[model samples]
Target: MFIRNERSIKEFIRYYPVVSTIIIIHILTWLLDIIPIGLFNQLYHLGVGSHWGLQNGEYWRFITPIFLHGGLTHMLFNSFSLVLFGPALEEMLGKAKFLFAYIGAGVLANIATFIIHPSILYSHVGASGAIFGLFGVYVFMVAFRKNLIDSQSSQIVMVIFIIGIIMTFLRPNINIYAHILGFVVGFLIAPLVLNGARPYYPPQYRKSYDDDGEIRFDPNRWKKKRFSRKTKQNFLWTIIIILVVIGVLYNVF
Candidate 1:
């Protein structure tokens, strides 16, 4: 989707302003820590940060804090995830839809954390929720949109996704629910973007995959151009449902 090569990096910066701006903003936001102490707080309260207080009248909280972070590691992990997952999703959906999905997932995930894990002294900050949204978007596409990713690649991606989830649970200080909420939001809305995005693949490539992810094609199934909407719904819903269940149980016991 996005080439990490030097030429492609320049292209992304020039062409993909939304994603580029997001990456830039997140980096600069992390650098805010180097500034004086109370200065960050002064800037944080201009109705940009999301917390339970968002419901009281701070509407911009839905979008602003997507740029903020907690520490060097927090910012780096999220920035890496965004760079990894964002380009293709952004390319597939176009800039507007891409940005909408990013912010939408972030806002909803923040709201979930606000509702479910509020604290007076602590705050939920970071782009992991939004990055997880991109994470889910990629996973949903690979699973349901046949040949959007080949079987072997998709299997590897799922393994990586599972590991990320496992790591999320290991960090008790983090708001895991926010990540789940963002993932679910991205999964549900991916189909809408797919409809608008043009298809990409090698025409010579056969549509082939067995239940176990081995390449076993049925001619009847391959004849179709793309999977049906119902198929997309079923696949993404099942993944997110399983994820949410695991997250809930993790929090509970």
Candidate 2:
């Protein structure tokens, strides 16, 4: 279910426009943040999840921080997680439902973070909360809707989730409240959104007919030669793990 089969960047965007848009926003926001323009600096400050901002009725901080990142590492990790897992849920739940779940979880997580940490200096950023919300949806499926996800994918989800939680505590400048709250919100809302949801299916290739009136099928006409799907999934997870280790080391040193 986590496999991505789009043949090109265009196809990938067309197939999963919601996820694509989110990643694009993440990149653009990060770029604006790093730029030294005065207005962009105000944009970053206005968007950060600051307790003072929330207390002063700058409520949009709850939603805006989801697209903001503290650094390149923060944005890349969250964006990669979205790219790795967002497409399947987007496909299964349809665009509207998936978007609601994602943004809802993020907003609620920020609210919860504000409630739990009332200090005026407290602030955080990144899409980790919403990404954890996605994990929450997968956790619900693995526990209650087993038929929707294969056992292998279920195993992957559980393993990655455990690692994520561990890293939440280990990593510096992390928002523990947002991560946990986002996950809880996602799990709680899963049943409502997942109702009548279907399993994700990769893009299909059309069949061709020979001149002799026989139908011929090229199983991989649209797909390029690459690792088997199972291998690809494994490799993807391996790269995620490596990235996680690198992040940890970078933070430590």
Candidate 3:
């Protein structure tokens, strides 16, 4: 007899909020490409490869490159992976912390790329470096929580890393160095990002049972919970909208 042990759809959804958000952004970016507006393409041109490395200027390129993309396929693949990995990481680290980690890793990856290929005028785009960083973080988390060599997660990550290295050597356009650097940085930062997170517990079990058999988890019963699904959704949407607006503005002006 076959036994299905899949998680509930709701549970799957909860584990992938960040991933869904990234996918939405990717779809939006793709849509912008087909629209009559020339804004997204223009914004992309300005954003990528705008950093200064050993050069005398263009210092902002280090951070701006992460927002850029070379084409629809590039953005789609990168964003898909982001969605796959980002939510899991974010849920573990909290949305705010995850955002910081993503942006920080992306910026650092761009910097590393710029340092390595400073004089290349060609624009570098896509979220590969940042996504790779998240991969690193995932691997690190799994390794920390389980056996490094024997764990299925760690083994899978190792295979991915090996494949990435091989692809880097095989492909002329791939940014292998950036991927490597981002992975290292993400792995290094995972522990810090995940510090002090309460161990996984069911929602119902999260509440405390006092000696009197009453719920005693609340420090101030009068005060509302600090964070919830609604709060997280609102915060996520706000950031997405702001980023979209910025992209639009960049295209128009």
Instruction: Highest lDDT: give the candidate number.
Output: 2
List ranges where model 1 is wrong by over 4 Å: 1-3, 37-41, 45-52, 118-122, 199-253
Backbone clash numbers for all candidates listed? 0, 0, 4
Tens digits of per-residue lDDT, candidate 3, 65-127, equal 665565665665566456434554665577777877777777788777777766655456667
Ranking by lDDT: 2, 1, 3
User: Could you tell which candidate, 1 or 3, scores higher by TM-score?
Assistant: 1
Worst 10 residues of 2 by lDDT: 206-215
Ranking by TM-score: 2, 1, 3
For model 2, residues 74-127, the per-residue Cα lDDT tens digits are 788789889889999998899999999999999999999999889999988899
Report the CA-based lDDT of candidate 3 relative to the real structure.
Answer: 0.59
Residue 118 in candidate 1, Cα distance off native in Å = 4.2
TM-score for each candidate, following the candidate numbering: 0.71, 0.88, 0.64
Kindly indicate the candidate among 2 and 3 with the higher TM-score.
Answer: 2
